[model samples]
Target: MKSSTIRTFTTVHTWTGLLAGFALFIAFYAGAITMFHDPIDTWALPKQELADARVMDKAGAMMADIVAKHPAARESIGVTYAAGHPSHEVAAYWMEKNGTWMTQAIDDAGAHDAEDHEHGLADFVYELHYDLGIPEIGIYLMGIVSVIYGVALLTGVLIHLPNLVRELFALRPGHNLKRLWQDAHNVIGILSLPFHIIFAVTGALLCLTLVALMAFNVAIFDGKLMSAFERMTSALPDTAAMTAAGPGADAKTNVPMLPPAELGAIARKAALGAGATNFDPDYMRYVHYGQPGAAAEVRGTSEKTLGEYGMVALDASTGRIINMQLTGARDANHATYSAIFGLHFGTFGSLSLRWLYFILGLAGAFLFYSGNLLYIETRRKRRNAEQPMKVRAMATATVGVCIGTCLAISVTFIANHLAPYFGAEPTLVVQPVCFITFFAAVAWTFWRRPAKAAVDLLWATAVASVLVGVLDMALHGDRLVRTLAEGRYDVLGVDLVAMAMGVGFGWLAVATRRRAVEGDPCSVWAARSPRVTATTTPAHDG
Candidate 1:
């Protein structure tokens, strides 16, 4: 690449990264934690005792009773039979009139009246990644950010193409701060290029689905986008017919509904017959439950395949198989689509792959953080007495948003640990607490110098991260020991990861403080101080 072309590409890379880096940082960091979503849920609700097999065996009766009592459940209901988390086992869910999901768990006595407490820790963190916990507009905003991120990735590759191979392994730690940051950024970016590309494409697809549908309807599909979507996702159960059937239709028509246990067994057999050897049904949905036309769809994970979740649809009334969309049985196009989702969500492989994705996600977060630092460093005034106001502002915002996001996430862990003592709805309280902590950190950055703010916020995040792990250990030390002995590592894994994050953040805080004192004096990251310049009078007087 020519110098001029490289500069233009560099400009494109810098601006796009600056525009999207903050949101991407939050997404990547939260996403890293969410890769272990089930474990985090287990960590938050550690005291849940596992229900016996009898609970699952009687799931059909329990679900029927639940629908009988809550007529709205007849519109659509889902049963979870074998969730790894105890709280999630044998749970039933239905959509309310207000479009909210209501859930109930089957107790040890095989009743459906067990209270469903919110599992906010993992869920809230997951929400923060894609939507920043904002309901309506957050997703669209993140969609746009993902588009910009894709652009940044392309332009970055263009700018670095010439020296990419030569400098692939270069990491020069020297007096020049910008060079050090640039080198670090390039190495991580190059190594994780494929991962970054996958995230960009999948993220845009996930977040912009509705927007793209609307656009296609208006532009390309001639108002047939919904029809096209229906065709594309035909494997999923059709809930509209079930909803239109209304409650008690089967009872009025003298049709018998199959019990939940029978439906589950049929679905399992159908899934296996369809070639999913490792299928374990997590969710089952019934349509027209009790009528002769009643159908059941069981969706579950299939291990050792890229298609993580597959569906087996069966006739609930006669135990006849209707259709199977198992992992190995999917059509080429549908299988590719399923593989994309599985890869993006880190559900395609075993523990080793999950850890790889987790580490890469955190490294992706670092890539954005270092990009921001490089931006600040590149724009610093070398000969001027003080840094530009814009550079200083960018520095402050980057420190506030990035570090604050980490702090808020750590605080949420603490909030989850203390939820019982707080005696309130943990979901409602934890979200607000995160928002307050994030905005307060931003506000504090404005009050203090950029360097001091960075150091302080990083330290705070370190403390909170370590504190969450310590608190968890204190609360569930015996349980952790027992689970470890029994080879149940979910909660223990989460705690260990949290403590590792604390150590990582602590090291970053120390390094950032050291840089502020010892790095280039003219840089925005350095603490502002008056430079003393001594002048000697000429010898012209002699």
Candidate 2:
């Protein structure tokens, strides 16, 4: 790139990064933990110790009983037969536009099986990471930010290239403030280039799918394309235009539907027949149950990454599969959509792939952190406090927001466990509290001493969050001992992690305190700022 272009890119990268750094930091941190979503789920909702339970009765028999009991659910689907809790099995949409669904888990005689379902903490954490602990919309917004972030990344690289050769791993320790930040930012960016690119492309596709469709429409379809796309993607039973009927048949608005277990079995068999490797019917659907041609569909995923992967929908009466083409299936539209989904969610790979993404994500977060520090530090020597008021204001806001994000996340974990007992829904209460508190912290610290605020907040986060874990251990009931002695790793695993977090927090508190004691404004980048009035490091306090 030309020198001018590089400078332009650098400016874009720095500003964009600074703007999004705080949100991205929390996102990346939570995302890293979400990598082990399943394990975490298991840890929070430990297995019921009833794995050996048997499916006593046949699916068909139980399904019969369900239908007989709930006669109105006659147009119902299949059955799910399991003695113990199993991965969701059975497809059943509970729409009563036509009829009610009464799918029952059954033993051999077709009676209902007893099982329990509980929302677990791991799922909460998963939500927190992606959605800023918000509801569904958070995911889409994050995706939008990711797209803007990609633009910033490209620009940043362009600007940094001019000095890339001059400062490869360049950490000028003493008397050089800017060099420390510049080195930190540049190195992490280069190291995680591949990861950043992957996220950028995927994130763009996710957030801009609507835009993409619009472009395609104006360019090729002339604003009319849904019909053709649907035709290519799936086999819709009725494509013909129906003439207006003189009068609709006297219709019952609500009718009882088939039993869930039998509906699941039918859906599972169809899915298996459709060549899905693991045909487990989960979350069944029943549309217009008890009405003429009522449909029952089962949706699921298979091991195949880019092949036929969705569940098969079976005609509840005839047991004929109605539809099965998923995005993974080979078709122009489906393949493209599947790839987009895989890229956005990191679903294309397993735990290892997720870990790689997580590490790169954190590196990306670090990139922004360093970018802010670089901006402030570069002006430190040349510009006094009377430097452009706007520049000073921007730097203060950046530091407060960026550091404040770290503190907020620390608060999230603490609030999660405590909010429940405070007569509040933990996820609802904790997420907003952490975010609002964080915003308040940033605004308050802007005019007050920024450096001191940053240090104090970090310490507070370390203490508050770390203490949550300690409290959990101290208050454990008999369940804790039982879990440990039984060699069940779920509960034990989380306990261990909590303990580790406490230790990590304590360590950070120590390190930052030492930096303050030693008169350094920045803890990690000690050479940049002169020490505080104190001579000793936090390590050597009274």
**lDDT top scorer:** 1
TM-score of each: 0.90, 0.71
Q: Residue 136 error for model 1, in Å?
A: 2.2
* Model 1 agreement with the true structure over 449-476: per-residue lDDT tens digits: 7888999999999999999889999988
Cα RMSD for candidate 1? Answer: 4.6
The list of candidate 2 runs beyond 4 A from truth reads 42-144, 160-175, 211-257, 269-282, 302-309, 325-330, 381-392, 475-491, 498-502, 505-542
List model 2 lDDT by residue over 1-542, tens digit each: 77777667767776777666666776766666666665554433222233222342243344445444554444334433232232222211121334433334433233443322222355555665566665547767777778778888787666666677776677665435466666777777776776778767776666566566677988999877655654454433333211111123123433344544556667666656655566544345444344445555555555435432354555545566666655334556666766666665566576567667666666666676676667766554241223345545655676577667666656665666566568766536555766687787787666555555656666666666566556555555455677578675555555565556556656756765554456433332232344443333333111
The C-alpha lDDT values of all candidates are 0.80, 0.55
Mind sharing the TM-score for model 1? 0.90
TM-score, candidate 2, is 0.71
- Maximum-TM-score candidate: 1
Which runs in model 1 stand beyond 4 Å of their true positions?
Answer: 57-75, 96-119, 218-224, 234-254, 531-542
